[model samples]
Target: MMLPSKTVLVFSLFLLLNGILPSTTVAAARTTIGFTYSAVPSNSPSPEHVVAALQSLNIPAVRLLNPSPTLIRAFSYSNISLLLTVPNHLVTSFADNRSSATLWLYNNVLPFHPRARISLISVGADVITAAGDSGSDPTTAIVTAMQNLHHALIDLGIRTVSVSTTFSFINVITTAFPPSSAEFQEPVNSLVIKPVLEFLEETNSSLLMNVYPYNVYKLHGEIPISFALFEEGPFNFRDDVVTGVRYHNLFDMMVDSVIAAMAVSGYENVPLILTETGWPSNDEHMNVEESKMYAERYLQGLISHLKSGLGTPLRKEGAAETYIYQLFDDENESNSRRNNSLISDGDTMQQHWGVMYNNLTMKYNIHFDNADQISTVLGLLVPSMYFLWLLYDFRLAGILLVLVYFHSRKSEGLDTKITFITCQIFTSRFISGLLIDIDDYFCAFGAAKTHVSRSAFLVSTMLIFSVA
Candidate 1:
């Protein structure tokens, strides 16, 4: 039982070398997760509470339907990334003139940037749905507004910013069952989708899509509930004749549907970010347990997908960042109004979707036992180690200075000689290659030499001219 002091010291050193020490080593890895906020219609919870709740959950981003001064101010000091959207009604006006777009950005966006961490500017909300509406030809206006806003942002030196519109049901290619052969409906694509895709491709902005697999399951009762919810079992449906891709869960099927549509429109390379996807915790027809199970499964699958760094069946290696539909269920905007059939009157489960309840208590424990140990180690070691590394590099930097001095002196003499020789050769070559006839032997010989020994001769000529 009596271990030697040296032996213990050696064991401790081994553990530290192998990264077994409980010292914090901060990794620069961060996930940009976001939630959508709607401040109008119903007085939603205050941004303070939202920010506090999201901060506690380690979420680093948020997308707002409309930018509110109160919300922006509340989150001013926080490091959360904000993606603000212009309302559907405001799109036409904003698109009509550069002045309007400039005013909007100046008033709403610029005031909060570098402080509130605003990153993306979505121009319009659900243009696909607006286009499908009976009496609204809002698509063209909205797209034009988005284009104007994008140019305005660029003019203002907002190079890292992105501008795009979000699309809902009408933009999706939902029919192809196995998921790969899915294509957008012709009428919708021709009028609204194609132009949007073209703009997104040209601007290098992501195509934001709101995909809810919960809707697919609710609408089509034939698909097994377990399969739709991503339960651990073999799916009954395995094959598709169209694209020949096998799908076990609704999420993959849904993603593949979008990919298929993008490929059809020749916009397959454009990034597709899931702007919204979440399950309602309450529904009368659907089992409450099933709703919870679906939510848990969906989040787990999403986290795994992000960590895996893989894309859907169609885009097997592309950016696949997603934003879960909401942070909390909006009772006023749920079910009938938003076509969210997952919420119901009798069950209070909709309100329970809050990872932290109204009282700010965590709904369920997110198991981070494995990460906790790593986090602890990282917290203790990274800062000290980084400083030590910096100091060590700084002390050795004199070597770089000495090397530069010698290099400069050596280059001086050779450079002048190179310059003279290179200038003479360049002048001779130019005269032969351009002014002299191809029939002349000297011109033909010069052209042949230039073509055959192009790379080597150019390098030599440049060095000679520079030295001379």
Candidate 2:
């Protein structure tokens, strides 16, 4: 279907803004959804009020992209899980000096861990990714900073906090179709992706992927909107001949693309966590009704999908732990049109990527409790000793292991599930080169059998062990 013309689109926008149109979303099962909390002025809510607001809204977790003690303090004593960030520009200094990392933690996270629910420390932003940040490959800087800061966290006895970094999906994925055929491009794959995956594997950390299906639909109009929205799609299904997995939504495809890329790169069991994903809205670009519909449908669908515990088509046992792109809009950033280089729609959207207005008013319709309340056990991951290498905290992984172990045992017999999950997902050579008894694990498995069943056990095993 061709997109609506400018006239109709404009009229629609007008009506929605005038409140003639309403934003509506279907009910969906709850999932763990957080939002990006950009810094606001001190006393804007006096920190205490902001924390109260977040709790009252039932926000499960929050990712603070910018370093804001005030915001962190606001979340302190609140139940919300906090994912703090390290600026990209600081990657160099943090990587170079252990003291720099320590100092950062002392200020940002030391005073607040269990109290603030400091869950993860993202190493850097994607802003510096395009040119490698300050002339050095920012990915490398990220790796180093993550390693050192992890040590700092450990030294500080902050065991619950994991270290990770964000990567743009477009930067890593080379092909997305047919799902199974996905792989990462060179230089990025070898230089960035491979190392990053290895670091995550060793650390028992997830590759924080920032995916924007909204951008995909906007840029590639041929793709169905439902594909991006996580809603029941117009296509409904796309099959991968090799994987034999049928994809119902664009999110699983995009996510599994990274999984496939990791599998191809010899690190089959690398885990994933979503650091950013959301739709945008603005009066000039789209109407309030349209904007509300975008958030409602997309989020409701995503919440239901995640809570289904079906995982993705490819990794049935793995769940996506996702954080929404933003809470409230940033006025200054939104207003900056970059000298009017962007077209009308793009300009409108540029400043309007928020669930609420910067003034803390709801821009669209959504229930805070449904989007928050983070403990949604949608899927369990297979264990890998190597995957668990750098992570000293094994409680979370241990729980998943037990759940998946029992789940597997109840179904396809223990031997096959554990063996396949561990070895099949591993690269051919890695499996071909394991120290254990291969036949005892594989039995008389025919080529006809699919390989996802036992991957959990093996990945968990790798996660437990540290690789040199």
lDDT of each: 0.61, 0.62
Per-residue CA lDDT of candidate 2, range 6-40, in tens? 23433343333224212121122234667877765
Q: Which regions of candidate 2 deviate over 4 angstroms?
A: 1-31, 40-46, 127-136, 284-290, 334-349, 368-468
**Candidate 1 ranges beyond 4 A from true positions:** 1-32, 39-45, 131-134, 169-171, 283-290, 334-354, 364-468
lDDT of 1 by residue, 1-468 (tens): 222443353334333322421222222322344666655545456778878877877777788866877777778888888878876667878878977998888888777777888777887767555544537677568778888898888888777778888876434564747566678887778767788889989988888877777767866777776666655575545466776767667777777778878888889889887777766564535465435555666665555544343455567643345676565555665432343333335543243343445555544444323343554565456545545544433343334335444555576654443333433443334332222222222222222322333444456445533443
Task: Give lDDT for model 2.
Answer: 0.62
Output candidate 1 Cα RMSD.
Answer: 17.6
What's the CA error at residue 467 for candidate 1, in Å?
A: 32
